[model samples]
Target: MNSNKAVFDSLRNNLKVHYDGKRFSYKSKHDLKDKSQLLVLIRKFPEGIAVIDLKDAYPNVMDDLQALKAVGQIWLLSNFDSQEDIAYPNDPRMVIKVDDDLKQLFPRD
Candidate 1:
């Protein structure tokens, strides 16, 4: 299977994780004191899912993505316009393409 397929398959078989509308709750356990991108946070789980914002994301997204690959399988969501720009391995399943998705998740009340 390809990288995207691998991520989806893993998400299906492994445990499912949720986003708290903020940083992941398990950050403390993993010693991720510094603000990390959503990709980095997903690595905390043996396998998990999360929607990340490309705007406030970490600078070294590439490194974070590599780290996730090492830990296990993962699927991420982002507001990226071009999939080719970030799809290093060309794993479409690795990222969920969504525009204004995060805004809806966290609306201004």
Candidate 2:
């Protein structure tokens, strides 16, 4: 029983260390406050907000948008664009919408 308890403790410590490292790395890469604000703004427009509007409000919107996109937290949609045209963040016609999973995370007041 004592040997089993020792192994469990070792595993727990290892997991804790790994979790903390990931948390720190994530926080360092993204500004939680800014990301939260961006999410809330996007949530306001269920039909999706234009990239130009977001850029106007947040000058450095691309960084946060890209980070969120990389993690599957948001989607970029083209507005009446050709199928071959790639949606770019700088394109005013591009629309941004938050992922359904994240809608609950930033509920409207």
The most accurate candidate by lDDT is 2
Could you tell me how far off, in angstroms, the CA of residue 104 lies in candidate 1 after the best superposition? 51
lDDT of 1 by residue, 10-55 (tens): 5444333324444222222232323343544554443333333232
Which residues of candidate 2, in runs, are more than 4 Å off? 1-33, 81-109
lDDT of each: 0.42, 0.54
Please state the error at residue 86 of candidate 1 in Å: 9.2
Scored by TM-score, the top model is 2
lDDT tens digits, residue span 30-92, model 2: 223476687766665666666654553444777887786676556677667643212232332
